[model samples]
Target: MGSTILPTGMVFASEQNITENSSYSSSDNVGVSIQKDENGDLMVVKTETKARANVARWGAWQYTHIALSTGVTAGAINTAYSKGIGSVLGIFGLPGWAIGNLLTAAGWTNYGNSPGNAVARLWDKNHNGWVGFYKRTGYDGAGRAVATAYKTE
Candidate 1:
């Protein structure tokens, strides 16, 4: 007899018969079956399955970078504003000048120099400083996510 072509592109010749104890198995998330048609022809059946899993996505890296950069920029701006305010207050006299100097120094230490150094490191491209900054931000974001998830539980 001539070979019969199955819908799945498998060809079965009439002389070849499926054994009675034929079995099918799948290791993946799928189902497999072997059956016979009305004409005693072997048929292979397959069932497709989709497996779903809840996984942590790394899409927050971009946001983390943006946030870090924004924080640094805002720090710089705030420091400059405070310096301006301090300089204006210094014109008032001795105690005012002392307080102004204190504010200026605090602002420089808290916002200006520290954040400026970070920004410089981020833009230095010659060194791996950018990687360090990005990695720190990524770690911070991942830590926050874990902490928040734990708190909700």
Candidate 2:
């Protein structure tokens, strides 16, 4: 068996079993399983899956930044978590300029510094800051399959 990590962040791998003439190869989102069918003919199974996620990290000092930023309180974050970032912003009734300032001060790397981007991210469905979307489709040797996972974490 051998594997390679490509520059595009895709993974490529292959393995072979000489005795049974079976083989396998896969990349970031696709795979092929090659084996002999009952009739001793070569059969290939193709599988594909797609997924996406993102995260950003901040130092403990970020808390200091938020604390020092004007008009933003600890409760602000709590409110966003319990409700949504849009709700929190709505409660403030601040102008767009003020909202931009607030987010810039509190923003993390992956979260945007602008009001619209920040709200969409912080709300992130559950407000835990973890969001994911994925889809899987193709043959898995035994049967064809199609699935989608819109969110997790």
List lDDT for all candidates, in order: 0.29, 0.32
Clashing pairs in 2: none
Error of 1 at 5 (Å): 20
lDDT per residue (tens digit) for residues 87-148 in model 1 = 33323222222222222222223443344454333333345333111211111323322111
Instruction: Report clashes for each candidate as comma-separated counts.
Output: 0, 0
Best by lDDT: 2
Tens-digit lDDT string for candidate 2 (33-151): 34333444332333333312111211111111111112243345444434444555554443222332223222322232223445335424345443222122333334434321111
lDDT of 1 at 140: 30
lDDT of 1: 0.29
